[model samples]
Target: MQVELNSVWQVNGVDGLEKALYRVLQLYMKQRVVILFPLSDSKALLRPVKIDFDNFSEAIKVGNARPSRYDLPYYQLQYDDEISREHLTKRDEKYTLIVDLVSNPDFLLSFVERPRSKLVSLHAKTHNTYVQNIYRALNLYWKYAQERNALLPGYKNSGGRGKARVAGEIKRGSPIQLSSSSIEAPKGVNTSESDKELFIKAMKKFGLRGEEVKFSRVYDKMLKEYYAEELISAEAESREAKVPNYRAFIYWVKKLIPTDTLIRKQTNQGDFDRNKRGLRGAATDHTEGPGSCFELDATVLDVHIVSDFQRNHVLGRPTVYCVVDKESRMIVGLHVSLEYASWRAGRQALINSFTSKKEYCAQFDIEIEESEWPCSHIPLRLLCDRGEFICKDAENLAVPLIGHLSIAPPYRAELKGIVEHRFNILNEKLVHELPGTTKGKQYDRSVKDPRLDATFTLREITKLLIDEVLEHNSSIFQDLAKQSILLIESGLSPTPLNYWNQHVKAQRHALSKADEVHVRSRLLPTTKVTMTGKGIRLNDQMYFESDHPDFDAWKIIARNNGSWSLDALVDHDNSSLLYVRLEEEGSFIKCYLKKESANFANRHQADILFFKDWVKLEKNKAKPSAKSIERHNRKKQVIESAIEDTKLEPKVGSKSKRTKGMKARRREAILAQRLEESGAKPDQEYSSVNSEQSSQRIDDDRKKVISILKRKKVTDNET
Candidate 1:
C-alpha cells in the first residue's frame, strides 16, 4: 500500500484498539517501521519503537490498517505563517518559545531517540534554559498537530463567555472603598431571579414602546415601584439599597433582549423599515447597461433661490427633478422649477431626458458638443417613488414612451437609491456651499437667515447645475464593483461618460430613440377643453383656436347646439399653446390661445390659476360692500314708487277702448315727448318742408349772399 510520508496511519483491530489506537510514524529500509501510541498515558507506550515490517504487515492485515481519521500530532504538520509572534499574548509567547526550540530537526531527532526526561535535561543544559520548559514543549508538541496555531493560548475558551453567575448572599466582585468615615461604602448586590423579573417588567413598560425612554428613567421607575420599601429604608438610614445596581440591571436587559429586537420594539414601523433596514442588493444589479433603467426623483433644493423675473424676490427652495442612469451612474436629465414635486414638474424632467442635451444647454448660454452630454434616449424601464408616478397621468409615459414603469414601495426609498444618492451628492458638494443654504441644524442657523442671503436666480442655479452634472459625469467613480471583460481589456477609467460611451459603441446599451414631439405630446398633462362659439375654452377661462379643416364646422355646430368638449394636453410651463385631440386615434392638433383669452397668453398655468384665485378672492371681499347695499335699497325704492304711480292712474274699462287709435296715439305721444325733450311749449306747432320748396329758398339765399360778397370785394380792391 502507498502511504504518504510524515502522515499518521491507524491500525484497527489491534490488541489494544478498543482502549487506544497505534500510529505508524516511519518506515525503515531494513523492513522495519516505527509505531507510536499517540493517545497512550503510559510513558513507555508514548515513546516511539521499531517493529518488524513483516510482523507489522501481518498485524495490520488482521487489524485492517488505514489512514488516521483523527488529526495528526504537532510535529507532523506545517507551521502557520499568519501567527505573528509580536501579536501573541504572554501565555501564547511562552508556548511559542517552547514550540520554536522543539521544532528544530536536531531536537526532534534527539527527542524521538532518547528518553524524554533526559533529552529535556540535555536540551536545557545546552540551551541554558529551564528543564520544565523543554518538558512542557515536548508534551505539547506530541499532544497537538505540529503547527503554529496549535501553540496559541486558549484565552478565548478560558472565560465563561455567555454563562450567567448564580446570585449569592455575598457579592462576587471587589469590595467597595470609602474615603470618609461618615460616608457609607456601597454594598453591591448580585442580580437575583426576582430582581431580573423586575428589570424585565420595567423594560417592557418603558423601553419596549414606540416612544423612546431613557434607561435611567426606566431604572428610576423600577426602583419606585418594585423597590419602594428598600428605597425608603435606605434613604432613612442614609445608605443605598442592598439590591442589584444599575449596571447589573442593564446587563440583564441586554442578555434578555437582542439588539435588533430592541430596535424594532422601540421605534415606529415606518422609521424602522425605511432607515434601519438592511440593504440586501444594489440598484445596479437590476440594470443591464447604460439606458437600461433610469431612476427619477425630486427634492426641494436646500438653498433658497431668487425669482428669474425679479432678482430681489426670494422664491424659496426650488424643487429639482433628476433622472439618473442606474448602470452608468450618470445624471442624464434635470428639471429645476418653482413647481412642487408633482406630475407636471416630473414630466418636464422626463422630456429633458428624451430630448437632446445640446439644445437644452444652449438655452442657458452653454455651448457643448453632443458627445459631452449625449444622454437623450429613453430607457427601457423607469423607476420612481410613489409620489408622482403613481397616478393616471403617468400612464401616458408607460403606454407610449418607455417600456416599463416601476413605482417604489411606500416608505422604501432604497429601491431608487441611485437618484436619491445623486440628490445627496448635489446637496453636499454644491448646494451646501452656496450663499443661501439651509444646511445647518436649527440652533446653528439661528445666527443668520439664509433666505436674506439668497443670490442665485432659478435660471442661474439651473445653469450651474448643468455644469455640475457635466463635471460629475466626467469625474472618476471609485466604487464600481463590477466591470465587463471588454471594459477591462480596454483599460478605461471608471467614469459615467466613459462607461456610457463604451456601452453604446459596443451596442450593449438599451437606449431607444424617440421623436421629441411625440414624447412631449405624451408627457404633457391632459385636460378637457370646451369647443364654444367664441373659441375652445380651457378651465372655463383660457381659450384656444385650431386651424384644422373641421374646426370651423365644429364651432358652428357648437354655436347652434351646445358646446362640446375634447381631450387636450397642456404644457403647464407655457399657457400659450395646447394639443387638442379631435379624434380617438388621430394625432393631436396644435392649438394656440385665441384673442379672447389674450390676457392669459404668454403666462404659465400656475400664474393663470393664481390670477383666477385672486380675482375670486377680490370678488368675495367686495360682496358685502356699503355701495352695493345702497344700490339694492335704491332699486327697491324705485320699484315701490312706480307701483304707487300706476295705482294712481285711471284704469281702462274695456279692451276696445284701450286698443282704439293705437297708431295715431303712438305718433302723438312720440311727437309730444320730443317737444317736451326740446323744452318747447305744449301748444307748439311743427311744420314739414318739401324738398322742392327747400331748394327754391336755398337758391334765393345763395344769390343774396353772392351780391353782398361781390360788393365787399370791389370796395376792398378800390381801396
Candidate 2:
C-alpha cells in the first residue's frame, strides 16, 4: 500500500498493545520509513521509530485478520500550513528560539534520533544558549510531525483566569497603619456572601441610577448605611473598622456587575445611546461609492454675524447646514442662514447639493472651476437626524427626490456622524478663527464679549464658509481607512476631491443626473399663498405677481369672488421669487414680488418675519406710553367740544325746508368764511367780473341739473 508522508496510520490489535498510531515522517531507500508515535500520556515523551515498509504493512494486515476486524490502510492526516504559520506568527519569541535551534543540522538529527538525555547533553555542550525544558520541546516537535509552532508555550492556559478563590481565615489584604500607637489597626475582613449582598444593595441605592455618584461618595454612603455599627465603633475607639475595605468592595462590584449594565444604569438612556454606544460599523459601510449616500445635519455656528442688509445690526449666530458624502467625506453642499436649524434651512442645503456649485459660488463673488466642487447630483440615500427630517413636510418633499430617506432616531446624532463631523471641521477651520467667535469657555468669556467684536456680515461669512469648504475638499485626509485596489495602484493622494474624481473617472460613482429645476422645486419648502385681487400673497406681507395668462383671470375671479389659496414652493433664502404650481402637472409659474411687497424683496424670509415681529412689538410697546395716552385724551376732548357747539345751534323749520337750496347755502357760507379770514372788502371792478362769472356758473349748474332730472325721469318711467 502507498503511504503519504506526514499521514497517520493506526494499527489495532497489535501483539503487545491494543492500538498504536504512527505518523509517517520520512521515506528512505528500499521502502524504509521513519515514523513517530505520540503517546496517550501527556507527560511521556514522543517516540520516533524506523521500520521497513513490509513490516508495517504486515502489522496492519494482522490487525485486519482479527475477529474484530480493523481497516487495513488506516490513515488520519491533518495539517494546515496557513494555520501553522498563523500560530507561529503569534509567538515571535518561541518561534524564533525554535527556528534558531532547529536550523543546525547536527542538533536537529540528534534531537529526532538520540534519547532525551543524550539530546539534552548535546544541546548543552554545542550551543551557548540553553533550553530549560528540552524534553518538552522534543515531544512537541515529534507530536506534531516536526512542526516548529507546536513548541510554543501554552501561556493562554497557564493562569487560573475567571476562577474565584474562597476566603480563608486570614485577612485578604494588608492591614492598615494607625496614626496613634495606642489604637491598634483592625484587619479588614474578606467579603462574605452577606457582605456581598450589602455591597450590592448599596450600589443599587447610590451608584446604579441616572444621577451619577462618584465612587468615593458611594463608598462613604455604603459605610454610613450598611456598616454603621462598625463605623461608629471605629470612630469612637479611633481605630480602623473590621469591615471589608474599599478595594474588596470594588472588586466584588466589578465581578458581579457587567460593564454595559453599570454604564446603562448610571446614565440617561438618550445620552448613553447617542454618545457612549459602541460603533460597530461606519457610515460608508453600505455606500457603493462617491455620491451613493449623503448625510445632512445643521448646527448653530459659533461665530456671530451681522445682517447683510444692515451691517450694524448683529444677526447673532447663523445656522449652518452641511451635506456630506459618506464615501469620500466631501462637503457636497453647505448653507448659512439666519434662520434656525429647521427643515427650512436644511432643504436649502439639499438644494445646494443638487444644483451646480458654479452658479452658487458666483452669487457670492467666489470664482471656481466646476471640477473643484464637482458634486451636483442627487444621491441614492440620504441620512439625517430626527430634528429636521422627521416631519411630514420633510417626508413629502424629500421622499420623492432621493431613493431612500433615513431619519435617525431622536437624540442619536452619531447616525449622521459624517455630516456632524464636517460641522466640527468647518468650525475649527474657519468659524472659530474668525472675529466675534464664541468658541471659548464661559468663564474665559468674561474677558471680552464676542458680539461686540462682530465684523463680518451674513454674506461675508457665507463666502468664507464656501472658501473653507473648497479648501477642505482639496486637503489631504490621513484617516481615510477604505481604499480600492485600483485607487491604491493608481497612487493618488488621499483627498476627498481626488477620491471623487478617481471614482468618477473609473465609472464607479453612484451619481444620478437630475434636472436642476425639478430638484429645486422638490427640495424647496411649500407654503400656502392666497391669490388676491392684487397678487399672490405670502404670510399677509409679501405679494408676488405672475405673468402667466391665467394670472389675470385668477385675479378677476378673486376680485369678484373671495380670494383662493394655493401651495407655492418658496426659497426662504431669497423672497424675490416664488414658484407657483399651476393646474398642469409638474408645471410651476415663476412669480415675482409685486411692487407693493418690494421692501421684502432681496431679503431672507426669516429677516422679513423678524422685521414684522419687531414692528408689532414696537406697536405694543407704544400702546401703554404716556404720550400716546395724552394724545388719545386730547382727541376725545376736541370731539366732545364740537358736539356741545352743535347742540347749541337753532332748530330747523322742517326737514324739506331746511334741505332746500343746500348748494346755494353752502356757497354763501364758504364765501363769508373766506372773506372773514382775508379781512378785505371785494374791489368794485373785481365784483363786476365775479358777478358775470357767477351768472355763467349759475347757467352751467342749471343745464347740469336739467340733464340729471331728465335722465332720472326716463329711468323712473322705464322702471
- Alpha-carbon lDDT, every model: 0.75, 0.75
* Candidate RMSDs in order: 11.8, 10.2
Collision count of model 2: 0
Task: Supply candidate 1's per-residue lDDT for 547.
Answer: 86
Backbone clashes in model 2, listed as residue pairs: none
Model 2: how far residue 559 lies from native, Å: 7.1
TM-score of every model versus the real structure: 0.62, 0.65
Write model 1 residue lDDT over 524-596, tens digit each, in one string. 7778888898778888788788888888898898899989888888876457778888767888888998887
Return the lDDT, model 2, position 389. Answer: 79
Q: Give the alpha carbon lDDT tens digit for every residue of 473-546 in model 2.
A: 98887655355654576787788998888888999988887887788778876678888898888887888988
Q: Per-residue error at 78 for model 2, in Å?
A: 28
- Cα displacement (Å) at residue 559, model 1: 12
Q: Which 10 consecutive residues of model 2 have the lowest summed lDDT?
A: 67-76
